[model samples]
Target: MSVDDFKHRGRRKMLVDLLRTKGIEDEKVLEAINLVPRHLFLDSAFIEYAYKDEAFPIAAGQTISHPFTVAFQTQLLDIHPNEKVLEIGTGSGYQTAVLVGLGAEVFTIERQKDLFDFSKIMLKKINFEPRYQTYGDGYKGLPSFAPFDKIIVTAGAPEIPNELLNQLKVGGIMVIPVGEESQQMLVIIKLSENQYEHYEFGNFKFVPMLERRDK
Candidate 1:
């Protein structure tokens, strides 16, 4: 490995350590976070800060989520190998890459066309192939690919969308942030055919989950 590659690996290890200190205890989630190079998903200008547990602006006014947020959400999902997972936002594709690394069959959607296109290229370049990388409204979810084992929403929604709940398989989990401009509640829902359970994990801030595509 080159000097830069070695440095990046060291930074990833440090990042994993930080995540552990912050309560991210899922070994699989930590492994995936370390394996996927977060810097590659960021703009070159912000590459140096890639491993920090912080969010950064990306194209289409979106931001790549903080590492802690990503790890937190992924850990909540409790992903299993080859399980079908629906991701509501594909901004920067960093989270998608981590999910892919964790052995989930990822189907991710982005509302902004620019981010959709950019993330597709970035994920492909990194050899992180999601089952589907779509450009569409996240609120709609992906009906055709319904009944996912898990669902993750990267943006903050005003409320949980019924469409997403409908797409989740019975006993599946969905992690989302729900609120307006300020702090949002990190919600986890475990769905059954006729009933669902909700768990709130305190506050987190995310870009608003917009409806329709930005043309």
Candidate 2:
């Protein structure tokens, strides 16, 4: 490995250590985070700060989520290998890549065309292939690929969309951040055919989930 590659490996290890300190206990989640190079998902100028436990600005005015947030949401999903997972916001595709690394069959949607296109190429270049990457409204989810075993929404929504809940399979789980301005509640919903259970995991801030595509 080159000097840079060695440095990044050390950075990733430190990041994993930080996450563990922050109460992220899932071994698989930590392994996936360690394997994927977060710096590669960042702009060259911000690459140096990629492993920090903080969000960073990406294209389309979206922020790649802080590492802890990503781990928190992914842990809530409790993903199993080969399970179909729908991600509501692709963002910088960093979270998507982490999902792919964990062996989930990922379907991610992005409202910003620039981010959608950019993330598509970035993920491909990194060899992390999401099953479907769509540029459309996240509130609509992806009905065509309904009944996903797991769903994760990276953006904060004012209200949880019924459409997304409908797409989740009975016995599946959906983790989302819901609120308007200020802090948002990180909610986990477990669905059954006729009933569902809700769990709140405190507050987190995220970019708003917009209704329309970026023009």
Q: Which stretches of candidate 2 lie over 4 Å from their true place?
A: 1-4, 212-215
lDDT of 1 by residue, 1-215 (tens): 12239889999999999999999999999999999989988888888898999999998888999999999999989999999999999998899999999999999998888888888997888799899988888988999998899999988888888888889888888898888885455555555576888888878889888865543
Write out the backbone clash pairs for model 2.
Answer: none
Q: What TM-score does each of the candidates earn?
A: 0.94, 0.94
> Against the correct fold, how does model 1 do in TM-score?
0.94
- How does each model score on lDDT? 0.88, 0.88
Q: Estimate, for each residue in 3-78, the C-alpha lDDT of model 2 and write its tens digit.
A: 2498899999999999999999999999999989888888888888889999999998889999999998999889
Compared to the true structure, candidate 2 yields what TM-score? 0.94
lDDT of 1 at 98: 95
Estimate the Cα RMSD of every predicted model relative to the unseen true structure. Answer: 2.1, 2.1
Residue 181 in candidate 1 has what lDDT?
A: 80
